[model samples]
Target: MGKSQKKRSMRRHNPMRVPDSHLPKGLAAASESSSKTEAILPIIQKMQGADAAERKWACVAVSNLIQNDPSTRRLLQGKNIVGTLITRLTDSEEEVVVEAAGALRNLCIDGGYDICAEMYNKSILVPLQTFVPKLSTTLSQYLDDQKTAPENAQKLVYEFANNVITLLWCLSETSNKALNAINQLQLVPFLISFLGARQKIPLATVTAAAQCLYVLSDDNPPAIADLRADGGYIACLLSILQEPPQDEADPRTGTLRVLAAGILRNVAPLPPPSVASALDLDAEIVLPQLTPLLSISLTEVSETALQLLGSAPETEKPKDSGLKNTPKSDHKSPAEVGLERLENRLRTVQLALEILTGACATLPDPQPDVLIDDEDDDEEGDENSDDNPDADMATPEEAVPDSREQTQSLPSLVTPLLQLIQPTTLSFPPLAAPSPHPPTTSALSAIHLAAFECLNNIFLTLARDRHANAADVGAVWDAIWTALGLVGTQTGLGQEQRRAVWEAATGVLWGVATVSRGIVEPKPEQVQALMALCDGATADAQLRVKCIGTLEALAQNPAFVDANATIAVYLLSMLPSANGPSPAGTEPMLQAASSLIDIYSDEDAPWDINFRSGGYLARLQGSVDGIKTAVRAIDRRKEGGKELRRRGEEVRDNLVAFIKYRKDLGL
Candidate 1:
């Protein structure tokens, strides 16, 4: 055969080569010519197509495209595709609605805060709200027919509800405006109702609803009030925590518990009325449930478990069965798996601790009885008196106890919190080289800060309780001290973490000083540590204030006063304009000054004379001048500054009185 004919034969016989006639006409040419805009335009058009199947396919395509490509998401956003998707949310075709909801959910998940805000601006909530009841009805029907319904159909219903709830959850995290939009839709009650114990909802839907509430109510009072009004919501959440899904190893159950605990934390600090209601619900029943969660580490598996299930094919058998005939696989034991799951949920532990803190703060104080005059009067005179004579008498204002002072004991919280605060070396990735100062690994640092805050709150509660024993007080103090020491030794924590440690430490110390009432002595090391913190140039302003305040509390003890006389001197120096102290610093600075004056000044003439004789008068005079200067510089027109100026004036007056009385004694 000729060479050219041989080559032609080889091409025709080769299995890998395709004839031009076998290929779609001009496909390569179309691909080379099409721009991204042209490519997506067809999908966008299909999304708005009249046919339900076309719209569903388009929505799924859009969801898949946006999930894998950021530019595709921005393209869709720029094209105003969300508006069409939102409209499809209420389509008569359930498949179309599911695909549209799924598409929007993907947009929210990938688009971040800006996309959420855009969705809010587009008024997505109106359509979302309209669809919720319909979705719920459909979900109920599918669940009711679970045995007979196609498994895929039931799964689609679950995804539809889950997607809507997840979208709302995303919106809730956007900003206050978005959160308010959700609340304004009056969706809080609906979401809470989904959590009803009798409601037979998918676990994913319930978990999503709980998380939505948690995010919505974070620092949001009105939403919290709405949740509080839901008759069984708190009970429902508490019940979930109390009787978690029987499968401890199920990631969904762990997630459900974590979400429930977080919701409780959000509800714990509601306004006094709502808080009263929360307390009345006996939500503390979950404390024991939460205690065990403290040791569990939160893992991403819990977060993505639903997605994993959704992605798996229904016909696929359990992977475990594949290994059944072979030697047993080294699968993690249930206990080990439980520990890992707990460790994954460290944030849940933090939330539980915070809830305990708020719960302790809400314990009601005893009401005082009104004093009535017992003077006897003639019957005729009593009858002649005004019928409501007490009305004209101005009532004496009752002294309100500090919120912290109204604490109740939660002995159950102590052990779990101590366990969390106890230091353990955590594994970290190997560093490039050993250095003099290594920062704390992020995971352990977060755990430490959370545990320390819990410890501080517990100590504050203990300090205020008149019945707290010396042993309990000492134990808390020791925990605080140990945690503080550990924090101090950690070389590489971020500024925020360090600030947290300092604040927590100082807070506990201050609580001890206030609650001890001279019963518990301040440790010398703690005193010195606080003094050093005050002197540190890198210390945060709030931390400095807390340190100074703690020192003031410590100075109340005569033993502390003699040992840390320099703290008084340093504090007094801050009172002057030269130190450039912030207005927030004024109160603590003045308290420290007053405390020192009380320590040094005397009722008898002897100490006063000796104070003046020792050249301390000049130092006191400098402080007095400094306070006066600060008072003049303050903007008294502002309410906060007015109080600070008033405090400065009071300090100056006290110093003037002490100086004048000493001068009058003929010093």
Candidate 2:
């Protein structure tokens, strides 16, 4: 060979080669790509082989390759290895089936929607459904013949069952198509049966089965129905939860508890029958067990506790004595770790608030007017029979029964919720020293919003039940005001976060105002805070509308009519003009305007001086003109535009009526 050719050959066959990282970016990428490609073809060929052992080894090799490497996963997906695996799921050899199942489950680790869709299209669920029941039956038989069964026979059964169920859980999360397909196969009932037969089944198998049920029935009504039909499923889950973990190192305990709690969260929000069934279960015992889990440092445990409690819990934090004085290593600082823990805790609290909202679904409908039929002759006759005109407008206290005295006393969830909103003294150094970041502030805001939501639910429930005493109502009101002030001071937060805080603050304010209508008097600071929220230019329009609505609710109390007169003028100024943005804003604007008119027309309203000085009448005239102009500006041809015009016209007519009523009263 020539000298130049010999040099090139020597470079290609060098004993020591340059690492990819040391090479140019493009060269490194190309070399890594070439390596993955080189590995894919051999694995694919081996997986397609007729020999069970070769195919099984190929499955294991592919599984290891794609375990954590996204690039390898995509490469394998392109090579149709999943198709090979799915075919192997039905292999005659049990070892090959187990290996293929494990491989597919690994592929789905973080596969997300695309991988799940591909699996569904490849008819993966068919073999999974067929194999699951057969495997389950075989496992049961093995359990029955425990004395004569092979040593590893039970372990093998558990491995196969867990792999299939875990894969199903992944697929179900990808899309409704996979969920619906699985539901159609009627595996949910079978899965619940497995859970119910807890002592007979392996713990790992039971945990997998519970997780599968959680995924399948999450928001799907049909799956929920199948579980609810047995009625004993809830009891079975509770029993599993009540059993203490075998030891501290038992990993399966946490998984089983979380899954069981998740299933309850899903089932608790179903129709009345399902909710009633759940409510009848032993919450007294279940809640105490769940409350302690909230303070467990693990995010999964706390999150599940929040889910199960559904706006409920309390217990001391668990001590991790082993790690307390451990030597430091190359890892995140204490501040960073604390921030993560705080974020997770805030998320858990947020989930609890969500559950609280769901719990309200079972309460009696608070709005009695909706149920009253105006067309019924008897109802109309009864209304006419009342000689006192004011009798028809009786307060909620007089109209509704005091059911709180007779109903069961609910757990006190407010104490812990209030504690969460209270600012904590961070033991670690502040995160803002070196550079400012939002993780801490954002987490605080989330906690605040969650606390506000829980407070709102609590007050609403109290109002509906008519059980709230003066002290309880006062405590809730004070907490809401404090939360509002905190949100107001947080100018550094993002607009979206601030907007959420404002929305939640207004909701809590509205709920308190609603529940305390007749019992508690409005404070000036409370009125001023609400006014500031409505008048703030940067405030979200929805929040502004809600604040105005709350003010209107408070105006119903005679003691606050004079204070609300200025609020009425502000409401009039906020009326939508012809050139205003967002047509959707019209509805709430109209509602506010109507509420203002209601306030001003009240008998005790100090309308004489306030109306003259505030230009209230002229503002109403302007509002009517502006709305009419907006109506005319809308295109009459399109359905949406026509509807907008109709609403605008209705608002204008209402404004005109208010003006005429005041004029007739000689105000």
Candidate 3:
């Protein structure tokens, strides 16, 4: 025992100095046991010399009494108490140091800056920092130290580390400077290295590091690169990704998605790797694995992957520079075939989708029990005993792979991953409505965004190979229309969210125009719907602009040009000066007119239809009465409503010019 512990034990048991109240409660309560010699200070001093059993009894008594009284804990704050505890940290008696570390941990709890500063001043934090690394080295040398020696010792140290981390978390939460300290410590790196240690510690440490990285990287993109450099954050994260997924019912996949998003978003616009090798570990190795993750059930994952994918092959711009098309130049070499290699990529993606779809279908169903024998029971012997050093603290090779092997493809990864993300038939529980009533149809908004992205990929694929997957293209179009319709309804979506949905819908429209244009038909019903939408767009500035673009694409279709004379007349009237103020509305009508003019003026299909002859000319003549009627009604309004009068007159002038030109051109 340490000399100070020896002195303290003597003082508590000495016949000359000990008080009756100082007697241990258990000893005092015992009716048959009355050994006065054991109560004397000199006699108690002998207790320390008696044997390991006697010393254990004294240690237990001291621990109990100190815990029972708040005053006893406060008394330990004396300078001598601090020095004594530090001494035991290096003591040969394993029991002594373990108890001492425990006491120090409690003392540090909820401690103020002054106490922490004092600890720092005493070099306490340094020693605690060394404990983890030191534990590794000492495990072999100190295997036979005490009665439950190694386990108890590790428990004490783990508890101590846990307490320290708790304090650090509190500090990080309250002070940005403290968080900076943690990042500077490269604690993330430390935790990863120590993943070879106990599972709980690494889990706790890495999770904290993840949280810290999350806060540090928010909004600032370059910080992500810095974080990656800190002990290969990207590599460690990739390791997590390569690891086999837990069985279904586990939520870690969601957690992984969240962490991956934070890291990927931060590292956005990944710089060209410093190396120039063809099998660039950063690109070829990283991109293939990550591309598949774009199909994960999390929207954030797809979003992150989208951003990251844009960063690949920084050397060249892909043929389709816009968002929807896969960049043919994403790969560095001709063998990669850029966009041309999409067929092979699609096959790979299809395989993953099929697996994921099946897994989602079966994951939620309960299965029969099949328990395996308990192998961990023997390993965990007695947690309080430090004696079998090899017991629980020994590193397991299977826990994590070596740095080299970690780069290799994982086994059963796809199947397990699919099981975790299997989709279920979603229930559209009520959301706040225009009135408090049940919704008529369920929405797919609740489906994981990863799944949605997978569907998006499917759309892109089917759209690319329209001749082969015509039915799939049609089905995707129907689903897209349904999704847009659901989003358009007032099912409690806020304005911003609604705007986003509209934006996505417009994106889908653009995709269809580019990838599946051959499938669009200018059916009368479709044309009528398009016209009504044009009217609506004419009224709303935003919708007007978007509809104008869509309509222009529709005008390109030979089907529309072949069947409809009205389509040409429609284009002729929207020329800045259009047939009297379009009764439909201003913005949509003006935008539609603007678009139609552009379409007819195109080299391929010049405007040739006569607006003042045949069925087309009669249609224009019939529309004048409606314009005059609306103008007269506007003229009767308050005197201040003259703006509407001016607009109405302008519309009339444009209509007259359009008619005159058509009449001059013989149909």
Error of 2 at 323 (Å): 34
lDDT values for all models: 0.57, 0.58, 0.39
Best-fitting candidate, measured by lDDT? 2
With candidate 2 superimposed using the best TM-score fit, by how many Å does residue 163's alpha carbon deviate from the native?
Answer: 4.0
Model 1 spans > 4 angstroms off:
1-134, 147-149, 197-200, 215-244, 251-344, 362-412, 423-447, 465-467, 470-475, 488-495, 516-529, 535-541, 556-562, 577-588, 594-614, 632-667
Model 1 C-alpha lDDT per residue in residues 202-257, reported as the tens digit of each score:
66677677767776666567877777775466667767766637565545566677
Residue range 1-667, candidate 3, lDDT tens digits = 0000111112111111011222233423432233221233321332244454443333333333333232343333332344445554565665655555654444443232333344444655444555545554443333345344556665565544444444343333333334445454444444444332323332433344444444445433345557556445555554655566443232333343344444444454434452212233423443344445435343332333334434544455445423221112223433223322232232223323332322222111122233435444332222223444333321223322232232222212322232223322221222332211101011112222223333333333333332322233444445555555544433233223333344334434533443455456545654554455555444354454454455555556655554335555554354332345554454334444444434434333432342223355555555555554554455313432344344444555455556566566555
TM-score of every candidate: 0.62, 0.58, 0.38
lDDT assessment of candidate 2: 0.58
Worst 10 residues of 1 by lDDT: 1-10
Who is ahead in lDDT, 2 or 3?
2
lDDT at position 400, candidate 2: 38
| Sliding window of 10 residues with minimal summed lDDT for model 3 | 1-10
Stronger candidate by TM-score (1 vs 3): 1
Candidate scoring better on lDDT of 1 and 3: 1
- Go through the candidates in order and give the clash count of each: 11, 0, 26
